[model samples]
Structure formats: C-alpha cells, structure tokens
Target: GQVEGGRKISSNTEASGRFHTDWLNMIYPRLKLARNLLHSDGVILVSCDDGEVANLRAILNDIFGEENFVAQFVWKARQFTDARANTNISTDHEYIVAYARDDGFSLKGVGRDESKFGNPDGDPRGDWMSRSMLGLATRDQRPNLHYDVVDPLTGRVFPPNASTGWRYSKDKMAELISEGKVLFPRNDDGRPREKKFRSEMRSEFIAFRSIIDGVHTADGTQEIRSLFGVDLFAFPKPTALIASLIEQVAADGDIVLDFFAGSGTTGHALLKQNAAENLKRRYVLVQLPEPLDPSNREQKVASDFCDKLGKPRTIAELTKERLRRSAARIDEENPLFKGDFGFRVFKLASSNIRAWEPVAADLESSLLKNAEHLVQGRKEQDVLYELLLKLGLDLCVPIETKSIAGKSVNSIGGGALIVCLADGLSKDVVERLASGIVTWRTALAPAVDTRVVFKDSGFADDVAKTNMAAILSQNGITDVRSL
Candidate 1:
C-alpha cells in the first residue's frame, strides 16, 4: 500500500465523486465487520475531513441505520486557516461520525464541575449545591405539583406562583423537609430552596457536546516532538482527541481497536488513558507496511527515524516504534501504574495449514507427497496461532506455554484451549498430559468449554492418539481434536 498524500482528493469529477465512491467501496465491508466486533452497547467513531464527510455519513446510516446514528462531532482539528492555499475558506474542522450497535449504547458523561459545589450550610451529607425547586411546567399543566411550601422554622406557608409550580408533590415535599433536603429561607416570605448533595445526586454528568475544540493539529505535532525528540509524523492525531472519544464509550478493561493505526496514536492514547485512570485497557492496532519515500518531505523524518533505529522505513514499523516509545514513557512517568502496556504483534496472512484441492490425475501423487497438511517453513507457534484463528479465539487472549510430560503444550485463554504441537506422543506422555490438563482446568476454571488439540501426525500411532483423547474425556474434558 502507498500513501495517497492528499493527491487523490480533489474537486474534479474524476477525483471527487469517483474517488469518494471508491473510498466508500473499500470501507463498506470493513464497516460490516466492525459492527460485528462491537458489543451491543459499543460505539464506533470514524474520523474524516470535509472531503468525504457526507459520503461517510451516508454509508454509516445505511449500515447502522438512521436510528443508530448518534451524532456528528465537529472537531476543531486545526486553527482558522485553509489547508490549501488556493481555497479561500478555512476548512479547519473535521467530523467524527459516531454509530452504536444497539439502543443500549450510552456515552459516559463528563463529571460535573466540582468548583461549583460547596457545603454552605455545613450539612453532614458533605458538599452540596443549592437549586430552585420550582418546576418549569405551568400550574395548570401540573395541578397536583402546584401545591404551596411550608417553612417550619419560619412558621409561614408560601403558595405556588401563578405561572410555575412546585417540582414535587405535597407528600414528597414533606418527606424532603423531614429529611433536611429542603432548605428553609431565613426571611419568612423568601422562597425555600432544595439541597442537592453531591453524594446523593444521580444526574451529576454534564451532557456531551457535539463540538470538540481546543486540541489542534499543532498540538499533535508537539506531542510527537516531545515523545521522539523529533517530528516523526507530519499529522499524528492528538492523544487527547482520541482519548476523549474512547472515554465516552469504553470502560475499564475494554478493548479498543484501530484498523488504520497510522503512527499508532490510538494505541498510545488508550495506554495513556489507562495509566491516568488506573485501569487496564487493551488495544488492537493494524497498519499497512506502506513504505516511506525518501523524496517526500513529509516522510523524510520518519525515514531518518527508521535508519536511526535500524528498522524498515515503513508506516507499520513506525507505528510499532511509537507504541514502544509511548509505553516506556508512560511507565517511566508513572511508576505506580500497574496496568499492562504491552501489545502482541500479529500479521494478517494465509493460514499455516495447507489446503488441498488436488486434480484427479495428480490426487494420488499429491497425497503421497503432502501427507502432512501443515505448510513448509511454518513454526509450531505459527501453527498454534493458526488454530486460534480457525477456532475463532481472540488473538490478544493470553497464551501460556508449559512443559507437560517432556512435550511443550500451549494453554490459551486461561486453559479454555489447550494445544500441544509436540511430536511422538506415547502412552505415558498422554496420561501425564491429561493429568496436567485436568489440574490446570480445575484451577483456571474457564467459563466456556475447555478444548484440546494436537497435531494429527505428531502422535506415534492411532492407539496413542485414541488413548490421549480417551484419557482427556474420562477426566471430563470431552472437547478434544487434532490439527
């Protein structure tokens, strides 16, 4: 893959309409997959400039439906200046099109401004803020809630105003007064206010705003400069920008995914947020190995950085390095943070197990030569990861390796899946492996069914293989198979 470098986008018919359609064509399938990955309440935010904002919105609406479309946040990504010199209008803002998987999607609100809250009365309930208890509706609309207030200390009764009504019913108001939640006015005629304790308040969240400002492109550049001591990326996303979006939907220990992880900014932001909040959140980043051209001014810095680190001059390499640097910095900055900042690297490619579709003429020869279905030059670990894919397990799930009966066995997802790629399994080894699996299974206690897999050819004979499966089955491990 090669970087388009903004050359593919233009106002012309060839680039504007056709190019955007092409972009949507590429994104349509990915959007369907992303929807499947999302939780019922999960949200997905896609950032794009003005070029394809309308098209992006249309595609999202078609995929997620109009009802699931949340909001289009206008982010001030840059200062009030035109990106291109010829354009008179300043296209300084970008749009983040958000969509939810279902109606359960709810964004966590920003905490209330604590500065506005205080304990003026020194109430035992701690800090609180006073608010008028008057209802917004007219007295005619809510006749039942239009009752008057009575001040016990003042021994005076105050009637509701002709326009507005009391917020609570007479019985509820009496209960509030009994609980000291209603504030009595010093003057007999003064209006009684309600005491809203910070500890007891339910609606403390400030509503999310559709406009995001303050963070700009310059800030993003400065962030990279601070981290790498040089501008490695010309337009890295601001950590705060992505972190804010993540906080709105993602909770502690949730996984955040970024398929086009340019410079790994999304991963860096997730790590920073986890460190700041003392939470453990994981990230999955995918980037193409789009080579950096030395002739391009924007990519020269990245190219030099690659040369300095003795790594490949590609966007993928830079992305990984950025994550490593960001994690190291976070650990150094916050030594007390115990969250995991490590990420597993996975490359998308064809499976390690060979697929056979031999012709009738060559079928016999193919079977004789390729008795072992496993592909050549593939490592045991490679085969293990391929099994994880075939079994539809998350790649990021923890994988533990142990020596069971002198054979290396991999325990994945906390013993939910036990895979042994060892060769020449004997009766004693089978019994030992089964015992170890049962012990680990009991200790780990995976919520799902535990499964065991072995290389079909690795066994000494059919008897050993059958014996292993039978031993595991006798120990209540029914799900067992071979590669």
Candidate 2:
C-alpha cells in the first residue's frame, strides 16, 4: 500500500494531525523492536524505493548509530524495459538499507581469489602478490615518507613523488629492503612494489559489491506459476535475491526469520539453499491471516484459489499451501536427502487457561464457572503448549510424554518444563506421579532447573493438591505452578 499522507517536508502537522503520520508511525516502532531483537553482530535490512528511502535512512541513522551503517545496496529488480510508461521513465531498481547492531559487525564477504597470489619468485615464505607501495599522502602530511628510495642492488636513487609519497617510513623501507620484501624494477624511473605474502593477509575474502543484479522480479512470478500453476502474488521477491543475502550472513544451523512473510519466499529460498548446499538451516516466517477480498484487483485470483482449496480466504493460508507444495517438490527432487522438511502452523489466540471473571450479581454462578481452571474442550497438546509458553520454553522445543501412575505427563525441552494437565488427580496417585516426574527429570538432566506444572482444578480435593506439591518439593523440584 502507498503511504497514507505521502512524505511531509515539515515536522509540524495540520489541525487534523495526519500529515504523513501513518507510514512513519507504523515503521518507527517496528524498527525499534527489530533493533532490540537483533544480536550484537546481526544486521537489519529494510527494502524501500524512492518514496521513503530518505526517511528510512534518517530514522535508521537515529536508531542504529551512523557508525553502524553498513550499505545501501541497489537491487536491479526489473530486467525488461517499461513499455507502459506514462512519463517515458522507468524505475527498475530498489534500495535495501542495511545497518549493523554494532561497530564490530561485518559481512562474510565474497570468497578470495587465491589464484592471484603465486610463488613465482620462490621467496620461500609463501605465495605473494605485488602491491603498489605508493601512499595517498602529500609531503607536508608525512615528511618521513617523502625522502628518496635507493635500490641497493642497482645503486640508483628513486625520489618519491610529492603527491604520492612512500607508504612506509625511512626505517620501515630500509627494513623491507633488508627483508627482501620490496620489489625493484629493471628500468630507471620505475617505482618499487611491496611483496605482500598470502600467509600474512588477515582476511581471505574481498569486499562485496553494493550493486546487485542478474536476479529479477520476473523469476519470482515464474516460481509462483510453476508451484501453484497460477500467479497468486502480484509482487513476490525472487528466491535468488534472498538466497544471496542468506549466504552472506547466515551459516549452518542459523535461523532466518522473516517478520512479513508474503508468499513465504524466504522459507522456500532457505529450504532449496539448504538442500543444494547440504546444510542444516531453519526459518521462521510470520504473516497475518488477513482475509483476502475478491473485490481487490490483485488479490482476486488468490482469494478464488483459496476458495477452490476449501481453505480460508487469507494470505497466510496461501503462504502455508505454498510451503506445503515447496516441501513436496524438494522431496520429489531429492529422494536421497535426509534433512528436516517439516512445516508447522500456529496462530495467535486466547490462552487455554480460563481466567476467573467474577460477576458481583451472580456470585454462585461465577463460582460454578470458575471451578475448572482449564477451559472446556481444550486439547491436551494445546494446554501443554500454553504451559510451555508460560514457562518460557521454545515453541519448537521437543516434547515427550509418558503414562505416569495412569496419568498423562509431558516433558518439554527435555525437563526444562514438566507438566501434567491430565484429569483425575487424587491423593492415592500423588506419590506415584511425583516419583515418576522426578525419575524422568533426573534422566533428562536439563541445563536449567526443572519447572513442574499441574492442572489446578484437576485435583479431587484440596488435600490432594497439597500432597502433590509436597511430594514434588521433597524431591527437590521446588518451582511448580498450575494452569
């Protein structure tokens, strides 16, 4: 969507107070949160065009300090000429503004060309490259580097140029000559070069270019057409662009998170990249289930597609379906591959625990409704995941269950979160359940202390709840809670 009020030059707003406020107000908080979420070495890239590139740079300069500014990469998104141009002009490029979290951050640059350095002279140190020894300094800046350089073998003096002085001082130049690191020319007026050994180089990679090309938006359209046999998204990013970014920053086992996962291109990119490189990388994509409207020109086909599939008319449903097809395509292509191709969907909703809402007029009915702490018709797995969230466990954490004393118990993240949300908890089974949990906790031996939770209303009586807590506490599992 376009900016609500366009870019306002003035900071002050009109009486109605809507002067280019919608876009800025929406992006400012999200950028702040993204900065807070980034690790010290992590980078945040925001894609924009001529509309808000200046405003984005200004705000980013304020959030991530100017020193942390990485690069403003230009992606050539369009390959073909614009034939339907009203103004006889075409904008075929977009800016990806990147900023690092700290000054220490740097990209994993492109691979180095080792072929450029070879031991042709047989100096015995290693492969070396001849580099110019001229320095970008005037005689006034460094008086020591302006002196004449003598070729010890030729017995000839070579005066350093006033504009481009010698890179090293007189003492360093003499040391290099003694160490045979300075290369001399056979001609009379030729300046010397430095022998830079490959072993002494600090980095193996050279700097990456700021301009990106070859990958185009047309590739993304073709991908959608191949996967779904229809162009569902009007403007989807090509996987090649995202795959390039991933290769520059991410490594094996790294998590690639996309907050606005339109059409789930990032996931598709990471999956194909991992399969091609034989790596273990994962992705987390977050997209809203906003209902698509058939009236909209761009979303009409997508909404109709969802109708044909008997799914909800939402962008998120299409994203899920795309991922499903993407995973199946990978499996079909790579039959021998044995990596994770799992995709799971989760939505934001009310908690499974029923909060007590008391009505002053109907106290008796409130008590009856509040008798059960857990909500009615909630699945056991749903309640267990709720406990996992409350206990600060990963949503994708491993969950294992066991039948303890004829009751269902779940252990999450090994034993970081142990929960028993089962029904029919009585005094007779309290000791047996506690002992089973203790045994499991001992065997798992999680890094952190164990947190056990139970269904508060599942106890037959008050004495049974007390006994359950007491047995667990005696066994050293003190941190316990209930739904």
Candidate 3:
C-alpha cells in the first residue's frame, strides 16, 4: 500500500514498548548499513510479530527516516495454536514492514487485462471502454463536480446527483466534450460517461494486491519438507512469498541484498523467479555461520542435516545448501534455461596485508618481514578483492588485466581504479609500464577520477617507485598509492 500524501510526517514513537530495547539497539546500526547498501530504487522489507512491531518500526523510522516508510504488509498466517500468550485473542497475523532507500522506490504495478477492452465502435484511435463519469464524493465534499453538463447537439442539460457528482470539474468536462471523448446519453435520466481510449490510458498497469492472501506459515514448512524430505528449518519464509516481493520491487538486472540471510529464501526465490522469467536479477546474501549444536533441541535437525551432507554444522552452511538445492531443482525443471542462476560464497577474512608486530628485541627483523607486505600464501585474487572492498567498488564489477612491460596491470570499474601488484619492478620497466597505463587510461575515459594502487614491495628500489609515480603524475594520473 502507498503512503498517504507521500509526505514526510514526524514519527510518534514516544509510547513504543521498551521490552525489546536491546534488540532495537543491535538492529539500528544494521538498518543504517542496509540503507547504505541499497540501490537508488531499492527497498527493504523486515518481518516482525506484534510484540516488537512498534519498536522495530521506531528504529526503522530513526534509521531510514519516517518519510521513507513505504508500507506495513500483513501476512495473514493462521496460527494453529497461540496457547503461550495470556491474552484473550490469538495472534494469527504477522507484519512485514517496508521502507524505501529514497523517493525513487516503487512496486511494479500489474497490467490490466486487455480482453475486456475492444474496438466495438471501431474508432480510428484504438479499442475504447466507456466508463462511468461519476465522482465518488458528495456535492459537499467536491463542490466543483456538482455542475451541469450541457449537450450542445441536443441543447439539453443533465444535472449530476447531489450525493455523487460528475467526476470532473465543469472546465474539464467542457474540454472533454470539445475533444469528443465524452459520451452524452439521449435519455434525460441517464448519466454521462467517458469514452476512455485504449491508446490514451494513463498507465498500462494498476496497483497490485495489497493484502497477502492464500499463503500461510505452514506452506513454508511444507516447502522445506518437500525439498529436504524432512523439516530442517522451522517457520522458514516461503520462497513463493519472497519471490512475489522480489518481483514487485526488483526488475531485471536489479540486485537484492539480504543481510540476515535466513535459510537463504531470498536468494532461492530470486534465482527461481529470475530463471523462470529470464530476468537478470542478482542478489547478495550475508549470513554469519552461527554454530549449530546437534544436541540442542532448537537446532538438532538442521545441524544433523548439515552433517549428513558432509558440511559444517552452521545456519550459514544450511543457507548455502538451500541455495544450491534450489538452483539444482531449477536446472532439472528447465533443462533449456541456459543455466543463468548461480552464486559464489566469499568468507570474511582479515586484510591480506601482513601486519608488523614489533618487539623491542625483534624490531629490525619485524621491519624486514613487513617489507614483503602481503601475508604468506595470499593469492592475487584475494588481495584484489580486498582492494575492491576498501575502495567501495562493486564486487561484481568488471575487472580486466593487460600485460604491460611483462607485468599484469588490472583495470577495474571501467578504469576508475587501476592496480599493478606485480613484484620486481625495475626503473627501466617503470617508464614503459606507466606509459602503457597512461595510454590505456586515455582509451578507457572513465567517467570518474582514477586511483592507481601498486605493491610497495614490488619496486626494486625507491628510485623505481619515484619514477613510476612521476611518469603517471606527468600524464594527468596523479592519484597513486602503494600497497
């Protein structure tokens, strides 16, 4: 549902519950991070029950701002039992709160079925539909709509009902009549209607259903049961529901990020939906490998399931397994699908740069070891990805490398970032390499400023490093740094 007036209103959370203050504290910064990660047109949906819904909304308001509050979707799931609650009423419904990153956020509207529209009159424009031109408000509510529409051809006046007046003002009615798009009835009692043309429809699609219907919490458990042959995760969000949400906000080529990747339903749904529709929607799912103990009642099934699959016993492990199984299922169902769905897992690690830990007795030796810069067994790809994270470049951004003076130089983000981590750069090759980079940068013509990074230890001596920086600086490529 759309926010009323699309206006910024001050959120009144003074009376919100304090029971979940600790939960709110942890989620506040994460919401801010999610906002920063969103695309220009991206949106976020958070799920909660009645107990903490108000508190969750309050923090979401504080982080995303009250103005960006989009909707609070009601997922009406039938509660088989709510015996734990002391209240008289059973809590059968849950809420999914949504917020936009900016003003550009909008859900994809559903298109109107054209079967109802036809060119019965055969107008030159296109198929036309006659619609009632009556306003929903009373004469008191909209005084302007309570006006007379005179048929000039017959010179007869038709007055609107006081309870429901004409849809448009007198001036607009006159304009429509002049344009021959208004239908005046011959009978004195019949109301006038609008000749809306198929070609002139304001928009092709209408608002999608606001209420979540049919789907239930049991459906989620059943879906996992169907896939795993046992209920591995309890109350997992249904892939169908997540797919519907993804379809509404994310178009082709859009990215969906789920920081709390529970069961990887978001990724699973995105993959299945995108493959079915041949869309290029991508996703980034961040799930911590929370340890799961097989002996623990809550996690026993999932942890045992992970063990049977010969994987680590963690929620994140199962999340990845869910995605893999979902993709394999999609491939089996659609053998000719061109296999456009897949994901790579990247683990969080410390920076590849070797830190210098100097003891007073071993200061000189520590300096010598630090001279190497990169840690032992660290690959170039690891360092390259670390550079991407530090630079805030998209991890999926295009990266290409070229041989310059027998050394591989990498170009990233269409040359916005240039890197050369090759070792053993001599003064003789520095000029040639720098010159080649300058020539390539000219060809790239990136829309933004370029930053060049090199391995500090790669240079043979200080003179080689100075010469490389000097050559790049002289050619309007001054932003240079060493690893």
Best by lDDT: 2
List the candidate numbers ranked by lDDT, top first. Answer: 2, 3, 1
Pairs that collide in candidate 2 are none
Best of the candidates, TM-score: 1
In candidate 3, stretches whose alpha carbon ends up further than 4 angstroms from where it belongs are 1-18, 79-88, 120-125, 129-135, 138-140, 143-195, 356-362, 369-372, 376-381, 390-394, 397-483
lDDT of 1 by residue, 325-414 (tens): 899999999999988878778777788878886778988898977688888888898998888888899887899888878889888999
User: lDDT per residue, candidate 2, 147-230, as tens digits?
Assistant: 988999878888998897999999999999999999999898688999999999888887878999999999999999999999
Sort all candidates by TM-score, best to worst: 1, 2, 3
What residue pairs clash in candidate 1, if any at all? none
Tell how far residue 402 is off in model 1, in angstroms. Answer: 3.9
For candidate 1, report its TM-score: 0.78
Give lDDT per model, in order. 0.85, 0.86, 0.85
* Candidate 3 positional error at 351, Å: 1.2
Which has the higher TM-score value, candidate number 1 or candidate number 3?
Answer: 1
What's the alpha carbon RMSD for model 3? 8.4
Model 2, runs deviating above 4 Å: 1-20, 120-123, 129-196, 251-254, 272-281, 294-297, 327-339, 354-369, 375-378, 403-407, 427-449, 470-479
